[model samples]
Target: MMLKRVAVIGAGAAGLCAAKHVLSRLNRFAPPVRVGTYANGRPIHSSMYRDLRTNLPKEVMMFPDFPFDSRLNSFLPHHEVQRYLESYCQSHAIRPHIRFNTAVDSVRPVEGEEKTTTWQMTSSDSSGRQKTETFDAVFAKCHSSLSLSPSLSLSLSIGEVLHSHSYRYAEPYAGQTVVVLGAKASGLDISIELVKVGAKVTLSHRLPRITYPLPAGIQQSSPVVAVEDDGRLRFQDGSVSAADLGLEIQDHVMTPLYHFLTPPAFPSLFFIGICKMVCPFPNFNVQVQFCLAVLDGSVALPSRGQMEEEVRRELQEKLARGVEHRHLHMMQLEQWDYCDALARLGGFTPLPPVIRSLYEEVWRQRGVHPQKYRDLNYQLVSDARWEALN
Candidate 1:
């Protein structure tokens, strides 16, 4: 059978998972589809930051069939995650299908019609030769929410501003004062990591409370009340010492770079993840489910009614019934809404579902049940103000 050709750009977690899911469906039903992956560098998983570790536990971060080894310990470091990605490619036997060193420069539809897409992919081989290729369907698996710290305006700055991305080993800033900004996982992690290396660290949280790791091994703080000059970080109803300035924290997610790739076409692209943005897990889960549905023709697009209907059915049956399955639901929904808005604005109707059973499976796995907080003054989880319910 001649398969429908699908090309996935970016060889990261989202891209890899999309390919794996597509391949599984194709193999099972013999769908007329072919899958290919394109990446700028070799198909290795290296994070932009050096001190990076998967925020989620290894169990949650890894694929279902390919779990990380138990002997490797809990939190997987950046280098180890990269190695695991290589292993995932090898185990899935998709290495041959990936064209590494092929960086995508631009992505636009083919000519006038919107059904087809052509990516202006540029890549340099190991021999340092550049080449380009155009593919049918493109999935941008590239990392979206970049962590580069914004340049603090000179007027507002009391000290040096740095992003969690530039942070590596703490040795460079030893014996200096630092104020960490943002209050997300990266900022919190940096604050602790720096403190160990002898730099006096003060976390400058913009929010009312800093999200700390549960069970309180470390990195957990009381509450940040205010920021004091003379380089002191004060907690709500408590106080800490001041220090000499090495680094000052700034909110990167608040910048335009945080919304970099939110284009108004094939809207599924936006829900994957925002660099430092946090969303309720179930919302994200809905978005992922929607992506699978949209790509596989299990859920139709353009009709906001259809997407919302299917989502409602699934949430009531699968997601809301159990706590374990609920985390990814919101995540999935976020992606769906983002993509749907973009598609409507771009005048493209989403592909309707051809496989009825996949829709059933989405409902079954996610289960049918109403949201636990459905009565909290919100119309539906699909509403734009759904985040307020959280």
Candidate 2:
């Protein structure tokens, strides 16, 4: 059996690659399949901030077959990434297949007498016209939401409260006493950006104190525990403060997924770009390949029950090892093994030594000087070495 039609939700890096790869392998299908991409906006609703530069260099951030322009900086600003995605769509003829400004409302599986299932997708366009379409398969690359602590609730009378999702520019927060929760990438980057713009920034996280140098006016503190009745903030370490502005920088966790890709109960649907703390773009490349393999029967997955059990065991191990429930999908140092497993199962080349070396070097630089890391430039000299340019 061959897939006759596929729907790719979101036109971001992952969705674009999914569509491109599907189109590339049209000859493999008995009959060529039609692919459609849906996006709620202009296809650039990435969680990118105005001044944000990529943590990983462009060398490793690119798909294996496509390279970013060598003339561009190693660490590119957010807008450059958006432009690259736009260019990717145009170059691969993906834009014509996309329904921009259309939001997918629901996706439900229609069971059939045979084992195969079809998906009914309900979506609305910018004009509020609703439409329903059926597809042979679906790739959901939709954005997830940031999880905030349950105890902290803010009233309208409280000062500005913003999730990192709504964060765009630091100019709007120039003179406020900002308390940023979560010391992860966005939290740290936004705090530094705010401090540069004269905001008195207090970074609060449950993790151990960060060793990287932070600019003056940016201080670290314990995580916020609660919001008092009098509008005061309570901290984990029994500290209290009056916060004028709050920024939640915690990473967004994708809803529980099987193997971080498939929903256990629904094998026809797949998710990409859900794993965190890894080289994102390259990881997405391999994930999309694996999904295609599953669809084309090139890779055989276990029975539904077995796959669900495997996902449960993986999550249990992470939880037993003290990993947060929400962070079950985080690969971190385990990304290499995870990527290799995907490539092995999906019949793709593993990441090269150059990508690994560059990835590690950037990580080390980030640890040593989080604020100054992006200021340095790097070039991959070979498969095993990267040189930092002065």
Candidate 3:
């Protein structure tokens, strides 16, 4: 039998890390169905929007093993982040393996002799060329979210409800009143954009009233209660609104991943960078390493039933504490512990303490100085501490 290797088709930071380790150890590991990349070639469904800047600082968000360029500011615009990604790809020699301009059609499992499973992957390229290949295992690199951004099948009946993920620009929403959900990161940014385009926006969330000054066209409302017909919205504080459009936004990519990564039914299939309210790149870096550890059998996973039970218990605990069902993925505070546990279980170096210090600091500063928090810079003084710069 010939040994097969994993071909990381996506060039995201997480994918690159997976490739990096896989390339280093050819003999160790490789298996799958529905394992994919950022396929479908639907650039329009991308979550990026014009005029968007990263909510996370570069110091905390950079891949744990790969650092961002030192010259860039702590806070970065979307273009700068893209440039950093390009630089990382070049530095790590990751672009060559990625089949750009191609879309994955389907990945189905084929049962071989002895009950062994292999994945049959089908994909199409830019010229509409199609090909099929087999692999022992798979990695799902697809851009997934509970929101409509990546799930092409999901549709909201309310014609007025819009997904902020598909909003590339604000001009199209001009003169319309939009009610935005989840005032953490994307929601506020989109609200700002809508206000600039002469659209009235009601920024709704469960957090305490934001103290920062906002445009007259934008009003910060209490937590949302219900989505009524005719674009009417109710708030937990008992205020009602009739907005022209409805939308939702949050801090990170929304994906339905099991606790500590990997699906319950298919442990052979790996998923990286699915957790929300996390420091994206750092989370990806840790997750990819942990997945590799599991693949190599260094860290054993619980039985499928046990894994599902843990997920259920985690969700029920959150619900008991009154966590809104929609916000279950928001693991902002739990991220530190989650990453630490993965590192311990995988026998890998944990993220530098400075990362957490700076992340929490930025979170605090963001609420108090939403307008000017990005203006402040910070330098990592050591593995344990970060100091602010003027």
lDDT of each: 0.45, 0.79, 0.72
Q: What is the C-alpha lDDT profile of model 3 across 1-390, one tens digit per residue?
A: 454445454545666667766655557743211222444445542577778887778888888767778888898988988888778767766566677766767878788897656777788776778989887667755433334532122124433666777677888889987878878677887888889889988898878788877778988888676656544666888888776677766443332356546677667667676666788888877877787787777988887788888888888898899987766776888999999998998999999989998999999988777777889877888899888878
- Residue pairs with colliding backbones in model 3 are 31-136, 31-137, 31-138
Q: Model 2 RMSD to the real structure?
A: 2.7
| Per-residue C-alpha lDDT of model 1 across residues 12-86, encoded as one tens digit per residue | 665555566556666422221222433435433333556655544343344534666655644457788778877
lDDT of 1 at 193: 67
lDDT of 3: 0.72
Candidate order by lDDT, highest to lowest?
2, 3, 1
Put down candidate 2 lDDT per residue, 117-222, tens digits, no spaces: 9899898877779999888788877443334443367654558888777788899889888889888888888998999889999899988898867889998999
- Taking all chains together, the TM-score of candidate 1 against the true structure is 0.57
In lDDT terms, how accurate is model 2? 0.79
**Which one is best on lDDT?**
2
Please list the Cα RMSD from the true structure of every candidate, rounded to 1 decimal place: 12.4, 2.7, 4.0
